[model samples]
Each structure stands twice: as C-alpha cells, then as structure tokens.
Target: MTHRITVTGRAGGTPGTGRRVRVLAPAAALALGSALLTACGGSSDSGGSTTVTVGSNGNIFDMPLKLADSAGYFRKQGLKVKFVTTTASTGTSALQSGSVQFLNNSPTGFTSALAKKVPEVAIAVSGLGNPLGLVVSKKFAAAHKLAAETPAAQVAQALAGSKGGVSSANTKAEAGLFLKANGVDPGKVKWVTLPSASADKAALSSGQIDWFITSEPIPLQVQNQGDGIVVVDPKKAPMWAAAQAGYGEVVVATKSYLSGHASAAKKFVAAVQEANNYLATHQGDPMVMDVARKVQQGVPDEVLKSSVALVEWPASGSMDAAGWTKTLAFVNSLGALPDGAKVTSENWTNKYLPAGGQS
Candidate 1:
C-alpha cells in the first residue's frame, strides 16, 4: 500500500508553531516507501528491510538528524528513513497515530506526553539546557538603563509591570515555566503565543511585545539589530540551570516500535552519534546551512553561525540520568508536573544503544 503526505507551514516556525506541517498523501508510502523504509522491521539474519518514519520540528537543534539523512547514514545502516517536518502538536499526533515511527522533541514534550499516558519512551538525549534567552527591545532596555545579563527575575518583573508590555513564548509550558521560575506570576503577565521565531522577532522589533523568550540565533539576531538586549540568559538562570541538570532534547519512540525493530533502532542511534561528531568538528560547514534551509527558511548565514555557537552538540550516545532527574525536579518546582510525578533513570533504556554508544 502507498500513502501520500502533505507538508505545510513556514520552514522556521518555533516550538508550538503549526506552520511547517506536511500532509501525507494516500500514495506517499508507495512513492517514497523504498527510500523511506530502509531498515524498519527486518531481521539482521535475513537482511530484511525495515521502514521507519522520523519526525522533527525542523529547528537548528535538529540539524544532526538532517545531516544524518543527507550523509546517507540511515541507508548505510540498512534502514529506510522518511523525514517528516512538523510542529509540536502535529509531530506528537503523528507519533501517536503511528504515522511516524519516532519523534525528536524537547524533554518537556516527552514529560507532558508521559504524564498524559501517551505511551512514549525517550531513547536518547540529543542536546541539553534551555539554549534560549530573554530578548528585550533596546529602546526599553536603555530607557530603563538595564544592564545586559540582568538577572532573569528583574526581566520578568519588568515585563509584568510594564503597561501593554506583553511577553511571548513558543508554548504555554515554555512560557509558564520560565515565568514561574523567574518569580513572575504568569497570571499578572500578558502572555501570548507566537509560533514562528520570525513572527516573534517581528513583534519584538515593532515593540508589540516587551519581551520574547527564544533560543539563540534569534536572540543573537535581535542583538544584531541593535534594538534588543539579552535581559535574561536562561543558561545562567538557576531554574533553567537546574532543569538542564536533568534532561534536554531527547529521541523518543513508541514502546511497541522499539520492541519490534531493535536492530534498526540501534542503527538509528549510531548514525545520530556520528552526525553529532561531525557537527562538533565542522561547526560552520555549509551542511549546517543545508539543514537550516530545509527547516528554517530565511535563516541568514550570520544567524546560522550564531546558532551553532549557542547549541552544544553531544558527542556520545549516553544520556545524563542525574541531569534528567534534576530537570524533572525543576519542572515539579514550577508545578509543571503533578505532585509526586517521578522520573526515574528507568524511564530511559540503553539496551538498544549501539556498542560504546552508552554514556
């Protein structure tokens, strides 16, 4: 049987942005099946082929996945892989419906999913820490004579007290956690959702919002405009620092999918490890641009370069379980998780990791 899929949305929408969506047509499976289904379900003994679908929101953080595909890592590992470009909601939906075999998303998404009984398991962590910052208009910052690297609490307080000074976050969870952690009451802040990084940038530049919570490159872009200041560096914030002490970005797969395709799954992890190595060494390579172009349209070369500096590509296949536990605790502190919600090291499994891939 064949299936057709359609992809929509701007190439560079943020965490919750619904843009950058693809719809699979009825014949999509047949049309891209051979190319997409390499080593999905077959046995190592018979060299049987397995078809697996992998999804991402197409952000720079997901560059390694794109690099792996372009480098033919999956093919070499004897698996056919289909790349699905989607937003948070859509990607989660695809994973739930079995339209995609695995998902690459933030740890928050996975935590939320597990809390909701979504039956998803995190296999490996890609990147850690927030990798984001709070950007404020230079006019506002200068008028207040705010210092760069101002504490996040001060930034949150400023946004909460400003008239018509709205703050935007990619998702409620992201925005909510940031606010609570920084000592700002979300209820007292005018919080809005801007799905696209570009859209958020526009709002910041136009003074539509007093503050915007976004990852690097975007914050760097605002700095380049000379109209924004980094009032809060999440990397330095204690709450975010504690969260990063837990888990960051992770590779998630359905329990059933991992159980059924063990070898292919291992190969997938191995390929990712190699891609991460490449990214670390060739930080400014054009391949980074190629990956960026596919997901974040209109990403200037400077922004791409800045993003690389902000994101620290992992070198091994192992996850920091202790760090992840700290992250879970931070989430609990923000009331993002239910009381007594516990995340043990057991929530992850290294059995499927390739030899030497274990952290």
Candidate 2:
C-alpha cells in the first residue's frame, strides 16, 4: 500500500506561511513551424565546428551538465558547447525555439510536452528520482511550537487544519506529486507558484510562504538560512523507493538536432558520464563544495555536503525501465500526466549514451 503523509495548517497568508495561490498559465505551446525553424538554426555538419547550445536551471540536479563545460569535457569531445541559463519553462521554450540545441529538464516536464505532442525526445538520463524536500519556515514552526522533523501525516494534518500555504515550481510534476504523496491535496492547500530557484529562495527568506517544496541545493540553501525546517527527506523513505518511483531530470533534444548531430550528442553524454565518475570517486572532495557554492550561490558548505549524500548519481546517467515505470505510474495516479501515459522502454533509447555504459 502507498503511504500518505498529510500536514494540516492554514491555507493563505503572507509569503512563508502555508497558503494557496494561483499558478501562471502553462507555458505557451510552441508552433510546429517555429519548432522547425528553431531546430535548423544552429546545425553544423559532422566534422564541422559544431556549436551545440544547451540550457538548464540553476540547481544541483544539473551539476553534471555544468561540470562538463567547466572541466573542458565538451572540448574533449570535439564540440563547442554554449550554455544558457533559463527557468524550466523558458528552457523548454528555448528547446522548442531552436534557441538551444539541447535542454536539461526534469522528465516530468518532458512528459507534459509529449502529452501535448511536442516532438522533443530524451537523449540521456542525467539525474534520477525526485531528490526533493519540503522546507517549512523555522520561525513559523517555532511560533507555533511545532515539533522538528514532522512526518508527512502530521504536516498534512497541520496544513489541512490551519489553511496554511505551500509553494513550489508549478512547471515541474514532482513538486505537485511530492505534495500529493504526502496527503496535502492540491485543492486543499493554498498554492503559490514560484518559477525560478532564486525566486523560491527569496519567497522563503522573505516569509512569503509557510512551506515550499524544493530539490537539493535550494533546500540546502534554505536550511543554511537557519530559519527553515526540512519537514520531509524523500530519499531516506524506503527501498530507495523515492528514487525508483520518482521523476527524473533528463537531457533532451529535438529530433532534427539529434538526427543531424548524433555524434556530438553522444560525446555530450560521455562528458556527463565523466563528471558523474568524478563525483562518485571524490564524493567528499572540496571541489564539490565549490561547484555547489557556485551553482547555488549563497548556500553553505555544510548543507551542500549533506545534500550531496542525498543525491544518487548513476554511473551511466541512463534511465532504468523499472524507475521510469514507477515514476509514470505515480504521476498518472496523481493525474499529473494524461490518461494512458506509459513509461515503455520504447520511450527511451541509449543510442547516445557513452560506450560500455556510464562507469
């Protein structure tokens, strides 16, 4: 049986108090004509100087992508990589607009795009499961004399009882599923939508919402502020169950780009594999602290270190069928995906993954 943890509390208030608010409209659908144009914009033939533009959000989930560029892995692969920073939706837009050759986003986001019939496809799996947490304001928890490390049930009870508000990136499916998995019905809780990681951090720090669901790095940053409490750690739950049955962050590309520059894409995956190897070997290295600090900006070293342990970096950066099936099933249960959305093996391919897998 699936376990549900519910937190009951007030619904709406100033930021930092649990409240429900409106989310912005779903990102505008990209026109196929525009997609065709964008897909052809940055293409260069094989052996030519290939400039592959990529975009990603500022989060620890994307560290491999960043590390690839920072460590000159892209150069080693004979491809010129240009990185652009954008929010989840904008990054999707960039991919659709041909502004980027590839996009690093959660598979949940891609699931929405696929449901809409967008032609984008996943090339490689970057990060797995929803390594996320719900951070509540310590000031608010203290003000109410709540216990630290409340279970999902207690937190859901608190939110349901008091009408408190919760906030998260509405564009990603994991945020909503995380709430639902814990028994905080989206309808019952006051929801505020914060798109960017930076914005969510500000909303939390400024006391605009009582609780916010965020992935690693940001949660670590929130804890460093010494004013927020991590009410749930999805990783330590069960069977690495959280990892197996949770959403994934994937590297995606347009069909046109993939068809035209298959080799460069393969090289890109190899570079990420290299970075994952470095992360595994030097799990406690200070370089990770530096990367986390640079990527998250303002998050402390200790919190970043703790978060590192929570993240599971697969050696191959490839998707497993069982994990994908569980993720799709969970999202479907939440109605986050359309009816009959199956995570079949055909939905993914390792054609672009590194040689001999990710080790």
Candidate 3:
C-alpha cells in the first residue's frame, strides 16, 4: 500500500499560475462559447449525401456508429457522417451550435449535459453494457492478492487506498457508477488525471497508479503488455451483473435541429441501427475488423478482436424500458426521463417531441 504520486503535472495557467483551475468543463464551455474547443464536425463528402457530423471521444462503445460510417450504412441512408474527435471532458454545445449533428456518448455524459440545461435528446442507441474495466497494475494486483475472478466488493475494498488513472472527470464519473454499485466510496481512490491515452499506459507501467479505468482495447492492451491485470473485465459475468444495467453509448442531437430535421435525424439513426445489426452478426469478419481498426486506429489485432467481441452492439439500436429504468437508477437516481426525452421499448427516437418524436 505504498502511496506513489506521479508528478507528470502540466501547468494550469498562461505562465506562472501554480493553481489548478476548477470548473465544470461542459457547463463553462456552454456558458462561454469562448472555450467551445471545436474540432469541426460537419461537411459534405461524396455523391449527393447530406453532410452530417458526430462528435466522439473514442470510447469503444462508439464503435457501432464508426462501423456505420465505414460499412456504407450512412451512404445507405443518403448521409455522409463525419466524426469529430474530442475529449471526454467537454460538452455538447457544438451540437447545439450545429457544429456537430450528433454527439456520441454514454447516459452519464448526456445526463451531465442535461443537468446543465443543454437542450439535447438522444436520437439513437449504440453500444450497451458497462463497456469499461478496472486494470490494476501487476504489482498492485500481486500485492493485494487480486485476480481476474476477484469479487467486485473485494476489489472495491482493496481500492480504499489507491490512485486511479483517469482521462477526465467524465471517466471518473462513469467509474463512479461501478464503485457505487460495489458499495465503495468512489472518492476513496485519488484520481490522477492523465489526458493523453499514451500517458495512461505509461503511468501505470511506471507504477504511478494502482489502477486504471477505461473501455475496451486499453485494458486489453495493458494486459498484453504485462503491466496490468484485469480485475473487473467488463466482458465477464460479475462485472456485467454489477455495472452493465445502463446504456453504454447513445447518439444525441440538439432539439432545435431534431425538430426541423427529423428526416435527416431518422435516416442517420437508421444507418446506425443497420450498422449495429451488421456488427452483431459479422463481429469477427475481416471487413468488420478492418473497419474497427480504421475507426479505432492504432489498436492491435488481438485487442480489436477481443474488444469487438466484448463490446455489445444493441440489435437494431433499440433501448428497452427495463434497461432504461436501471439506467436512471444508476445515472443520477431519477426515474424521470432526461429533459425533453421520451421513451419507447425500441428506441428513444425523438424524445423531445410530444407525439413520440414526430415534428
């Protein structure tokens, strides 16, 4: 139980401010478009397809939408969807301003934005389940006598004094769900912010963090490199039973756009649903793997194969009420729907509309 503080800290100000800036990124970004932090999301591509853009933070749960772009599902819907690569620390203001047509995120993400009064609604469902894993450094695992099959509560107990590597508060929030479910105080572990993906692995390898939490391939890669052990494999029974009750990723857009552009929105969602269907059937196919590599770029074959298999692509991109009910419980504990969001067994569709998404 040695406390190791990784001193890879970056400055928080223009030149000499040694203090870290503390503010809610999404809310601040929304309040002042000055920090809008744009990566650009929309533009026409080819043929006569309408240009649409979706923002992504590279969570493996977003694979279904990426597959849609690669597999011509977007073309099939007369749309050319572009992905705006972004960080988990930002909000959906870009969607509201029409910089992006859709924002691919988890329920926790959307709820955080909604809590800030950002007017957006989920138009489609993507991946489901927890899609996240807890990777303990090999040394830490050996020290605590932890293993792949360790019970969730036991692992949670062991984390009472440990540092967790997180990309942002969003990652921490998502991980909080897992900790909350395991009856552990999420704040027990000191979260070390490592914004770059490369830094996450490096920090863990250097024994700077006791554990790391992230989705897919990262955990798989860590295991491959022998730097960490998968204590909470999202693919396993115990992990799923504990944390897979909520929506993993959803496609959302602003209410103003959805109100006027229902046709495009529905078409876009249809394409995502089609891609998910194909992914559900052709998971291990060469073409699927190729698309995965293209979308996830730089991921090794073994990692992609394992991640693709484990990442649950919801059939037809639908959401069920029971799943959503659990989602509400785990996400902010309110049975009430997201602001301007409606529900159906199959999908949220245009939840903003009173008549089941019909504008």
Which candidate wins on lDDT?
Answer: 3
Best first by TM-score, ranked: 1, 2, 3
Q: CA lDDT of each candidate?
A: 0.68, 0.67, 0.70
lDDT of 3: 0.70
**Every model's TM-score:** 0.75, 0.74, 0.73
Better of 2 and 3 by lDDT: 3
Off by over 4 Å in 1: 1-50, 147-160, 163-199, 241-245
Per-residue C-alpha lDDT of model 1 across residues 1-359, encoded as one tens digit per residue? 35555766567677555322233343555546554443343323246545578888777668778888888877687766778886756877778777787788877677777777777777776765666666778777876767676766766677675432323333344555667777887777666566576777888778777767766667766876686877665565644542444555778888877776777778888888788888878877888667766656666777677676566677775765676777776566545565566656656777667778775
Q: Candidate 2's residue-wise lDDT over 1-359, tens digit each?
A: 12333645565566734223222112212233334433575544457655678888877777777777777887788767878897755877788777888888876677877777777877777765566666677776776555545665666556543323334433234544555666676566666776555676677778877766656766666777786777666653332234456545788887767777788789888888888777766766877667767776776778777776676666776666766777677656545667755655555667888768832
User: On a 0 to 100 scale, what is the lDDT of residue 257 in model 3?
Assistant: 72
Q: Against the correct fold, how does model 1 do in TM-score?
A: 0.75
Count: clashes, candidate 3: 0
